[model samples]
Target chain A: MKFSKKDLIKLYTNLVRARTFDMLCTRLLAEGKFVSFYHEGAWGDAAGVGTATFLRKDDILYPHHRAHGFPHMIGKGVDPKYYLAEHCGRATGCCSGVGTVHALFEEYGILGQSAILGAQFTVSVGWGLAAKKNGTGQVVVASFGDGTLARGTWHEGANVAVLWKLPIVYVLENNGIAQYVSLEKAYPLKDMASLAAGYGMPAVVVDGQDIVAVAEAVGEAVKRARQGKGPTFVECKTIRVTSHGYGSPHMVDGEQRDMNMVEELKKREPLSMYEKNLLKQGIITKEDIEEIAKAAKEEAAAAEKFAMESPIQEDASILDQYLYAE
Target chain B: MRLLQYNEAINEALSEELARDEKVFLLGEGVGVSSLATTRGLVQKFGPDRVIDTPIAEAAITGCAIGAATMGYRPIADLMYSDFLYTAADDVLIRAPQWRFLHGGRQSLPIVFIAGSGGYRKVGPEHSHSPHSIMLHHPGLKVVVPSTPYDAKGLLKASIRDDNPVFYMFHKALIGMKEDIPEEEYIIPLGQAKVRREGTDVTVVAASYMNYLAIQAADKLKGEISVEVIDPRTLEPLDLDTILKSVIKTGRVVIVDEDTERCGFAGELMAQIMEHAFDELDAPIKRVCAANYPIPSGFLEKFVLPQPAQILAAIREVVK
Candidate 1:
């Protein structure tokens, strides 16, 4: 597939935006802004940003906990300040600090980003079924990690989606790690997409770190799903450069890494790789790259300033409210 | 007033609610065939879309209802048996309840989770037990246990309309039981308790099928022991004010619950009564509850479950 310079620049901006968000989260966590930090897997920026760019406001996305960049990447006119505010326990946060990092943004079609492994699959299938029933022509993208493929929920959700022919796209960011266990030990099948084959659905494997590759693959899947061709499974062989959480050093084969994998991971960095490709093709100039980085940094700075000014959630009786909708 | 069986009242309430709102739909196993009689004829009348019959995937079905509900649909998911609550615990206990608070309290999942409850039907442990206490134990849910056919219709209608996740549990053995239901449409709001029988010696607190036992036990001890029977239809938003008023008048209380004794609704009610009404009480409140063991299948349920005889004994003892 060919891409115009405009679309390519947009993708690059989103990828950088996600990276900037992750950097800010990490920096703030290190500065004791929050009690504990769980921001990790900044390496999946390509998958999160690329796939999200292809979705519409009506297209539901049940994202992973780490994909806090999803709503901000896709949603228009939405400030990144809510993400910072939520983590800072501010009243202006997405969930008034009742939710940290990830929460639902209904208007943006970002459903509650679940931390539960593989649990969003069934609900995603359900939203797909609802769209079909409501004649909305809305498709859903359920994004998760390779470890989620091991859960029965993923298999059951895929099976039901196929049986009912629901309009859904399952994106597996196969980062090769699940908490501490390696993917090879977590799943019996060599390919996560093979499970979709058993359900008679189209499945594909793509290089996850490459922005163009991830965008093109997920874009095609999303197209088929929107056309009501049932669900598609796209496995992105992603990379995880950071530890599972903040303060914890990266572990390599049960041994903590002290920059041992830095040279190797730098080669796989999505931003640098995409920048190199864009530069080689003359799609972007050196000035454009610098401008993008500056814009991302400014956005991060603006969000941090907004969060610092936002008030902490007061009202001790507030917890009593919203427990139920009433 | 029109006399109706327990299940008919539920059927009418579901039908009326479905007609009342376009968003309300029934999704669960055996909903098409109405295995429990509460959903009979709904699929045919409302069509398959509105009355969805799902496979044995309890977790998926329940989770799907949450998804559908989040997207402006009011799903009244019927789990056929309340035991299936454990299967969909992640969605029910964790997701549906927590989503509203976690998402800045902007969204309301108006889901009416209906499950068949109660024992003494000899249908076995899984089929015949009441787990309303489990719903009450969990935060973020409004638990409703309808006793009479009247409350069944009124409460179910009210639950469907309420902007909260409500566990509207119906006792299985009480399905065939009849009561006088109002001919005019009405709603018994959640959190209100009904005084079934009024007396002065003891305040008898009961719910669901246990309410029937309390009333029967109250009648048995009529002149000998004046017992006031209080039916807390909604267990979670308990009408404790009514019970407390009765407790102040009677200075005694006897609570009956179908759930086992330990950490049960009865225990919570007693604890609250002790906390709020301790100065008013003349003696320790008595709780007549199911044996602290798994309800056995078959005829053994008669021995394992709490009956009116046991309720009568507790009422007599509390008033003595």
Candidate 2:
């Protein structure tokens, strides 16, 4: 529950990095750099980076498409050029620009990122089962949104994970809204933690905006799993300040629809909130935070230049490759 | 040569594969104590480490197999019945097929998906059916339907060794049928067809249990019609070379499929034949397929399924 000076600084650096990366993605999409882009705001940084910091090199992280920040947080030293190239759909990108941004990196432990809801939850079980079967004691984290909680595979996968006592952790990012609809309209339950109780696994509800709180809660879950106990469901009450897809309009066709919660949701920017808390606690100066933000922006610019120059993915042999391991 | 039942031959293949490679393991409901008898005694042979018995979570388990396959483990998922394929279709049909291509060929998914397919012994509408053709609709996954015990052992071995995901179906009615299989280890390469009968009159295409029926029909009308029954054991990467050769020699083709007539594999075969070898055909490619309807309970199931009489009629019509 306590923290070190290095911990807070590391957290701040990752949040800044993620925010800058996300901003560049939005800017490129606006400039028509790519045909499509899924925009997740800066609010997701604390929860994504917080959880990823706890994973060891051997441990696996299976993220949904919305959690691009998780891999960016996994290691700050990753060449942003490869990631930017992937965004531009270039042959120089990791996966030769053929992979979407979600499924980009694997060497950094970003094993997979599925677009389908709750699909990774089930798939991670296999990874966890293998770890246990091999006696490796390695843990695999399965991350998804609150909307995916209603999916049958989530429960189906959780059932086997708990029954077999597999080393898998479920981290649910509860952003309160699925696409356009609010949680109240979709799930009858107020707290998703109770769903874990049904499977007899320990569950916790944490403040997603607080990176310290998320790390502490997920750290315990990771420990318990590594101890050969079972899976843990950690539901973080998070925020999403932008529209579900690329740019906001929340509209169908050409017409704009009603969005009453945007202004209220905008009030709690996680980065700003964390900075205010840090200042109040007398841990850091305003100039220090500014320095972090400046560095992140510079890194983002370098990645952008690299992506612009990268070549688009094209090859005559693409047809024959990737169909089989042979 | 040794006489082993269909399921026993399949069991031998699993045992040998598991022993041959420490990475190969079986996981599914009823695998510890195989309900269909195909996976029976595996847990005893391999122990719990290799033969895993999971709860009835089809979709999730299939996802688990895919993920494990990504991490260099060869997993054989038992679906219990092929009808329950819908429970796991999203991962098997979507993710498993695309993972190889999606990652730019960096990852190879080596997983064998095994299921009991066919309508017999009144397992009812949902349980008693073969959806192999439906599986063919998904690109990049291999489909294997083994009719005889010898092919069952060989193809199962070949599927496990292949780097791609192979969906293998075992005919429920043929599990008890016995055949003389070689004592020495063997693997019939996937995408190879076997000629059950040699004839110049007509080429009868059948698979799994349908091959058995086609052979029976060929025998019943032996003197009058010389029916050449060719079993294209593996659906994808189909041995069109052998099939087209027989088509040119016979100049007539009769396809018998248990799948529904509408949007079925039989229709796909007919189209491919027309596209490649239209000039060799003496008559329109004939088809004896199940009705485009669900298999209801009771004697109606038998009526709805493809029968030898239908194959006989198709042979007679095509030969004329």
Candidate 3:
């Protein structure tokens, strides 16, 4: 389970990149730079990055709707420029500016995400079927929030995925809150991974704040899936450091979060915690951290520039073009 | 040419497509047994890998079809009854249809959602209903409602080959109906309407089981009213051109639909006819559709559903 020093650095770099891009997008949204809504992946970076950083380019990923899948896409090695362009409604966007948050990158097995939550549970099963039929050893990782577990699709999808032993890994980012409802009020069980027991699928829980821990747990699940060992449920108990989405209240159940609790949770902030761990273990020095932070900021700046300069779609004829296959 | 029952025609199309393409697979709750008899004995030929018997989960079945299609495999998801489409509304109505378009047309979902549709089986409100109009409201889906065995086989074949999501709804009442179809491989292209009986007095546009009723009504009123029965095999890629031509010639139109009257296919067709041939109309277009109420079970269903008598009355009214 021990990652090589180089792999660790790569994971660290991806986490920083995801956080940087998310922060930039959130700031842009607040300034009205873009009209699209954003769900910040502020403290939940490791759940997406660690689970996706080691995946093969051909491996399919049904990214979680949180942060609009910025961390997951970046972890899978896709450049953020086109995705940024999509949010800006530029013609150069991945979906030709038609889909702001739902972008497709077929080469990396990044098909798209549904606006309706919990849809990935069922759709990912099909990808698993295809991978098994093709004998390509391509695994599918379907990520969703804790709130998505309440959907009926979770039961239906899990039952089949276990029955057929489809090559899929269901990663749950249990960030305590699903929009407004708290996790305690949503499900009866403390650990959502127990939901997998009804289907007899292997399940595990990992700390969402630790990128290395998430990578190790999801890495094992992905390996099992690739080896045709059926599906596995990996739950990352994480935190939502901000509101459900940008420009939304931080209240859960019509009550504001305790300011003291919010401050305490911020101390376990993923970025700073990982940086401190890397520094303590001698895995990365102060100067290395500074360089990585600077490079991520520069990359985010370049992507913003690319999106801002891209042309906006004006002609109405393009609307009918992608409606159906001729 | 060989005479085949509607269900047999569907089975033949599925068998041939499974053999024609390796990527094509069948998945449903009872696909191996196929209570509808359309998919019976398919598992024995294609084996379990292709002829998958799934849990009674509509959302998973449809979601799997969408997922498999995105990965370049054509999936035929059977919902048992088309009325059950409501169970997987997100996947059937939203995901399958809009996935390709919303993703900027980079992906094509080559999926066929086949199910038994319409009343006459007296299977209660849940099983005996044709919700094709709800599908029509959604733009991306292609809908095929075949009234005859020949059209059933040909249209189902075409739907499997299509590079988009197609809902191939076979009327439950027409399952036993038989017709002569060519033995050789054939595909009835979607969006083409068949003029079941050509006439010059009044044009009757009907679909699925209603097409059969329209033909019966035409025969019953033979000498009095010249009814031109136009069966639009595929509703989404509707051959409005053919219907308009008939409307222009006859100057009168009557639409027969098995679905409810309000916001039904009959209403949509009538509006389109008026829009295109307003001046040519000899009278206001009439429609014979099921009353706007939940289709009741038992003999009461007959009262709510469209009947040959209603088709006759609509034809007589339009001709007047």
TM-scores, all candidates, are: 0.96, 0.96, 0.99
Better of 1 and 3 by TM-score: 3
Q: Which consecutive 10 residues in model 1 chain A have the weakest lDDT in total?
A: A69-78
Interface RMSD of the candidates, in order: 1.3, 1.4, 0.8
Model 2 C-alpha lDDT per residue in residues A1-326, reported as the tens digit of each score: 67788788777677778777877787788888964575665676678777777577677787645645433334323466676777688777766766756454566555555667878778888888888877777888877788888889988899989988999889888887777777877788988888999889999999988887888888889889999998998988887767777776564324353445556766767888888888898878889998998998888888888878877787758757756666
- C-alpha lDDT of residue A17 in model 2: 81
Winner by DockQ: 3
TM-score of 1: 0.96
Give lDDT: candidate 1, residue B225.
90
Tens digits of lDDT, candidate 1, B1-320? 87999999999999999998998888887898887689999989999889988777777777787888778888898988888889788888887778788777878888888988888778887777688777776788889899988899999999999888888899888889998988889998898999999898999998888888888888888779988989989988888899899999999988888888988888998999999989999988998888888888877887868877788877778767
Q: What ranking of all candidate models by lDDT puts the best one first?
A: 3, 2, 1
lDDT of 3 by residue, A1-326 (tens): 87999998999999999999999999888887665789988888889999999999999998888888989999999998898888888888898888888869999998777889989999998999999999989999999999999999999999999999999999999999989889989999899999999999999999998888999999999999999999999999899879988989988877998778878888778888888888898999989988999999999999999988999856578767777887
Backbone clash count, each prediction separately: 1, 0, 0
Off by over 4 Å in 1: A67-78, A252-266
Taking the tens digit of each residue's C-alpha lDDT, what string does model 3 give over B159-276?
Answer: 9999999999999999999899797999999999999998999999998999998899989989998889999999999999999999989999888888999999888888888788
Per-residue lDDT for A130-237 in model 1, tens only? 888787778888888887778877766787788778889998888887766677777787788888889999999998888788778888888888787899999988
